[model samples]
Target chain A: MVAVDSHAYASRLRSWHPAEKAGLALATMFIALAAGSSLTEVTIAVLMLVMTVGLAGIPPGFYLRLLALPAVFVLVGAASAGLSVTGPGPGAGADFLVAVSLGNITTGFTAAGLSLATGLLLRSLAAVTCLYFLALTTPMVDVIWLLRRLRVPALLTELLELTYRYIFVLADLASQVRTAQSCRQGYASWSNSCRSLGGLINAVFRKAGWYSRQLAVALAARGYQGQLAVMEAEHGRCPTRAAWLAGLEAGLLVLAWLDRGHYLG
Target chain B: MAETVLLEAREIEFSYPDGTPALGGVSAGIIQGSRVAVLGPNGAGKTTFFLHLNGTLRPRRGEVRLAGERIRYDRAYLRELRRTVGIVFQDPDTQLFSANVAQDVSFGPVNMGLPPAEVREQVRQAMAATGVAHLQDRPTHSLSYGEKKRVALAGVLAMRPRVLICDEPLAFLDPQGQEELIELLEAESRRGTTVVIATHDVNLAYAWADQVLVMAAGKVIGTGRPQEVFQTAGIMQQAGLPTPWILEVYRELERQGWAAGGSPPRRKEELLALIRQAGC
Candidate 1:
């Protein structure tokens, strides 16, 4: 989470309008999910990867690693969808690509099941890449700023602002406590490590509560009147960039429509 | 000379909800446009007393006055008082709520309900004053401790308060950071804003402050110019604070009858000048 957040701030595309990036990501994701075609899904995934790694200038190795994080789940789910069991089969049906017979039952990879699995894998990965494109390019502050402009509730926005800021603080506190515990040999053994983990969690919670109270006092001193009002950063309009983004989205929509059943059969 | 008392606390008493006495009958006056340093040991009610000044924590028994008017706890009055008196808390992490440095600095001004242009001007000026204008786009978590401290100070300064109270402003700062911060505070004071900082550095309080307030046991034990307050042995011992080295060195020179016949030196440079004269 920290890596992604920091990278978002450092992205080359950070200066672009957040709404444009968000709209592009969400629209591409919607196309990938609704098209239900392997060609469209594959195109969307490749396009998003290029946008994030090439256009946004995120390191290619890091981007690949992030995409790999969700690949395991996709592979496992697709494998389940692709495998089939047949009962009382002397020989597996022609639909089976490879069959293994054990007693009266047989397990095999059927063509229809494999096709469904392939489609699921492509669609899920494409959607994930689209989401990552947005996440890697847009800082969370800009998203919250856009939300405020859209008239999102002040309470929710304030909560998001505080939560985003304190996550680093709490993480730092937890790491410091863990280091102290480790130095004291509190985690020398498995049992000891368990005890130390428990203590670290307890300490972090107590410290977080204390931090919140201190934050209240600090806020009060700053003339906070039940609201956290702050100026939104100015992101000047870029019509050329918007035009390019619109053209890209139009291309994706056309591909989704033209390749309606290219791979389904 | 009768100086205008910009902010005063008269026998203010307060206890925590757990019945722990944080302050008892604490009274002190801050002169307008003066550099006042609150010196004390740990848990000497310095922070608690500062909270009262900014109307964050109302005194249980006594009244706090700003410009000779009694402070009221009403929401309207507090809004006015807070606009005039801003506080920079000790921990910049807790004080800086916004991730963006510019946004954090603009919080105080935006809360004052200022027009958008004025708020922008205030934020810009505050960031410029604290030398954090270049860091406006940086994330708060990425800032160094010194940078965070300056950003926090900018946050308070954006309010354009008449009195700026900083709790332990010098703690956790490197020598350079400390020097730069004191210089910034001095500049703010030069602008006719009363600046009060609570710190444990006796040498700093002596050298930089026009008035030194020594607190112990939740009460102000001594309050006067640094020369008079630090010269009183009883107050120094009672507050568990060491005398500034300049004072000790000057007193030894005087005892040896080698010191120049003049007022005692309050700063290292002044003491050095005296030594240079005596050697000549």
Candidate 2:
């Protein structure tokens, strides 16, 4: 999360209009989901990877490392979905290719199940990459700007902005506590490590309570109303670029429709 | 001497919700266009008294008046009072709520209900004034402690308050950051805004402030020109405060008959000049 937050600020495209970036990434992801084809999903994933790593200048290795974080869960889910049980089948009559049999209960990978899992894995991955592109390219402040521009509820936007800012704060506090605990040999053993974690969590919650009071007083001093007013970034208008991105997304949709039945194979 | 008192609290008293006294019959008046420093040790009610001045905290006893009028407790009155007096709290982490620096600075002006263009201009000017214009796009958490402090000041200064109160404004700044903040506040003071800073650094209070208020426990033990108040050993001792460095040096020189001055120097260069003037 920290890496993504920092990288968004340093992105080569950080100065681009946030709405333009959100529109392209979100529209491409939706197309991938709705198209329901491996070609569409694969294309979307490839495009996003290029945008994040190639265009945005995030290191290819770091981008892969980030994607690999969720790959384990996705792969496990796919494997679970692909596995099937057949009632003492002699051949592929039960759609089972490879089987492990214990008496009359056979466990195997069915052709239909395997294809469904494959499709799901590709679809979800493409969706994940689309999100990564957005997260890696646009800072949270700008993202909130886009949401407010879209008229998302004020309460929700403020909550999100505050939560995002405090996540870094708490994470920093947690790390400092961990270091202090380790310096005293508190994490020298498994039992001590558990105890140290409990203490750290307790302190964090306590500090958060105190922090809110301070925040309220400071906000009041500055004449804060309930709504948090953020200034709009002047990226200026770029209709030509918008046209290009819209045309590109439209082309992807057309390609998805043309290759609609390829995944069924 | 003829300057109007911008803010005055007479017999103001307050206690924490836990029943501990935070202020006890504290009274002081801030003259407009004068730089005043509130000096005390920790838990000396400097902050509690500042809150009262800015209408953030109403005195449980006595009254706080602005421009000779008793402050009303109504929302509209308090809001108006806040517009004229802005207090930058000690901790920048608490004061800076927005993730973006420029946006954080815009909070005060936006709350003032200025038009979007004016708010933009205010944000721009505030950031520039505090030397954080380059960091306008930076995230709040990424800032150094000093940068955060400057951003916090910018956040308050954008409101264009007539009187600026900084609670321990020098608490966490580096020597350079402290120097920079003093320069910024001095500039604001030159613009005819009343600047009040609460600090434990007697040297800073002595060098920068024209008037000093000494607080002990929860009461103001003394208030006067820096020369007059620092000369009172009883008041300084009651506050657990030490005399400024230059003043002490000057006293030692005078006692030794090595130096004689028209008045005490406020800065090191002036002290050096004093030595030269004495032919020491």
Candidate 3:
């Protein structure tokens, strides 16, 4: 997660307008979902994969590893979808060519089931990839700015920004506490480790309250009003680039429409 | 005439909500454009006294004045007071709220309601002054401790306050970081901003401050030029502070026949020069 955040900050396309990137990703994802063709899903997934890895400068291996995480879930879901139990009552049909029988239970793979599984797997992978493309390229700061531009309430946007900032703060505090505990041989024995773990949790809870008070003092010193008014990140919109992305999405959808088919292999 | 009093507290008394005495009839005047250091041991009310200076904490029995005007507690006047007297707390983690350095530095100027371009310029200038210009784009969490301190200083500096107060500014700093910060504070003083710092390091106070104020048990035990204030052995002991090395060495040299007659040195370089002149 930390690596993904740093990569977004270091992304070569970071200066590009955030709205354009988010818009393009959202449009492609919706198109793939509505089209429902396996080929269209493949195109969306592949397109997002290349953009995230090649364009966004995230390492290809890392991107694939993240993609593989979803693959596990999709595989289990698709496997279940493809399986049908026709308990000895109905014989295998032409569509259900592959069958396995264990005692009275007969499990068979049917054409309709396989197709549904394929569609599910492809659609999910495409959606995950599209979201990853957006997250890996555009920074959370820009996304928050985009939210503000889209008329999100100041309260919600400020909360999003503050929450993102605190995630690292809490993680850093946790590591510090862990380090302190280990230095004192707090984890040397089983009972000691259990006691130390309990103390660490308690300290973190107390520290959260203490740190918030400190933050309040600092904020008051800075003349913080009811709202956190910060400088908005500026990104010039490029008409030609937006047009190009639109063209690419339209072309992919057209090709998917022309190439729709039905087959069980 | 005496230097114009930039900030003053007259017979101030304060106690924590639990009735712990933090200040007891403390009084001190900070002169305009003076590089001053408030020195004492722990629980000497250095922080409590500082809070009163900017009206962050009001005095229970006394009053604080800025340039002969009593500090007002109304929202608009308090905002003006903070704009004139900006403070950078010792802990950078508590002080820095933004995820990025540039945004954090812009917070003060933005609160002042400056134009966008002016805020940008202030942030840029503050980053440059603190030598964090290159790290402007870096995440606040990614910075080293020294870098974070500089970023925090930049955040306060961006406001361009007439008076800059730093509580225990040198705590948790490496020697190099300390030197750089001293130089930065000195430069700020040269720019006509009254720089008030609280510290335990007598050496830093001796070398850098035009005037020194020593506190003990919530009262001003000594206040004068560093040479005069540090020479008072009784005050130093009461305040739980040792005489600075330069002063000690210089006096030792003077006590022996090896030293020639001269003003006491507050810094090592000056002592060394005197030793060289005396053929020691």
Candidate 4:
């Protein structure tokens, strides 16, 4: 994607405040944790997914596509749990065909296995969805600004901002170098690939160092004194509606905690 | 000219850390509110000269004075000098490091220890003046080249420097962007800011600068009005620069026997008026 498109998304995200997005992310995680049954976890995960779709205005398919990549691990764990038995003796084979043994053992899939699989799926889904919502609904700058407001060290913030800026620059340079190398038949042979990779790494490092020096000099020219200031959001004099939504989310979290027998069931 | 010299560089000679000479025996005095253009070709040490203005680079041999006070080797004085003389680099990406545009613009004012409200006001005014108010929330990495350039200018304006130095301010801009920047520079100069631009574009120097200083091999070869400077073909050839287009057009008119040699027109409007008078 172009930088401008990412910037537009970031600008729209900044229009909302960071605290509100944090509240939503926390509420969804709590709800996903509170559900008891596998069915309940599934239902909560679906609801959270729907909420993200509605609030972030992203397509539901996009979330599903991202979740699919991590689902393979959950499936592996689930299959392994279903196949294991507690009593572990050689069980009778149900069928033998063409010198291949097939077995339907006496072992039944336990509620524990089902619950473990469901929990893994739900936890992974909730964590990924919460992070996705955070990225989609809040600009990274707002998150950094919130960190500064919470009194993060100025050096760390400055480092983070510089890291973010240079990461994109490095990524661009890497892609350009790779394209140029491929055009020169460097990737066709292993030795050529190694030499090309080494050259690219060295070039990128030298360019990054030069850019870093130039950035420092430019900053010094503009009176930079090693401190980065936080950006203050003009969030319309204490957004009453956002506060009400936050209160509602907090109330739901409390109710969920009580019903789960962890606090005051 | 003002009786008080706001900035003075006395026989300043500097070499890069690699021991390559960049500026050799350069001396210049900038009066308050003077719009000066340092014109030179590539590798003429134009950017190095600008770095010396704010003491980003200290002279290896000579001295620099601002507001009648020499910039001591102390860090505090260097900081004060930086706060007083703001520089806008040629590339906005180098100047803007903050995540968002407004934060980038506010960085200078905040570093200068302005109050929060005042910093906010400065950001707004700078953005407004540069016509980048709408881009305040946008990330610096996401802006188009033109918008990024404007935001960099806004960043410097937020510092409210008495002297504004731009390095090749119109280097990669299209004609429209160039015109807009020229207008912006003119407006800032009218506000009593001493504007110095280092550029190879003789046309911009002619149209925007009140006084031009031609540099070749780290030395000021000629300093005068644009017409007077352009009159010397030898210097222009040496610097790998051409005379301004308007000046060339006026010369062509004189060659056609349509007009007599006099003061050359520096602005397009002046050339238009001359052409109309010549019945062309």
Best by TM-score: 1
Q: In model 1, where do residues sit more than 4 Å from their true spots?
A: A88-94
The candidates, ranked best first by DockQ, are 1, 2, 3, 4
Better of 1 and 4 by lDDT: 1
What clash pairs does model 3 have?
Answer: none
Q: Which stretches of candidate 3 lie over 4 Å from their true place?
A: A86-108, A259-265, B260-262
Comparing 2 and 3 by DockQ, which wins?
2
- Give fnat of each prediction, in order: 0.89, 0.79, 0.63, 0.67
TM-score of each: 0.98, 0.97, 0.94, 0.87
TM-score of chain A of each: 0.94, 0.94, 0.90, 0.76
What lDDT score is found at residue B102 in candidate 4? 90
State the lDDT at A238 in candidate 2.
Answer: 88
Question: Compared with the true structure, what per-residue lDDT tens digits does model 4 show for residues B10-47?
Answer: 88899999999999988887878988899988888889
Q: Each prediction's Cα lDDT score?
A: 0.91, 0.89, 0.86, 0.77
Task: Write one digit per residue (lDDT tens) for candidate 3, span B102-214.
Answer: 98899999999999999999999999999999997788889988899899999999999999999888899999999999999988888989999999999989988989999
**For every candidate, C-alpha RMSD to the true structure in Å:** 1.5, 1.7, 2.3, 4.3
Expressed as tens digits, the lDDT of each residue in B207-241 for candidate 1 is 89999999998999999999999999999999999
Scored by DockQ, the top model is 1
Write the number of the candidate with greater DockQ, choosing between 2 and 4: 2
DockQ, each predicted model: 0.87, 0.79, 0.67, 0.59
Q: For model 3, what is the alpha-carbon lDDT of residue A149? A: 95
Off by over 4 Å in 2: A89-92
Please state the Cα-based DockQ of model 1 relative to the true two-chain complex: 0.87
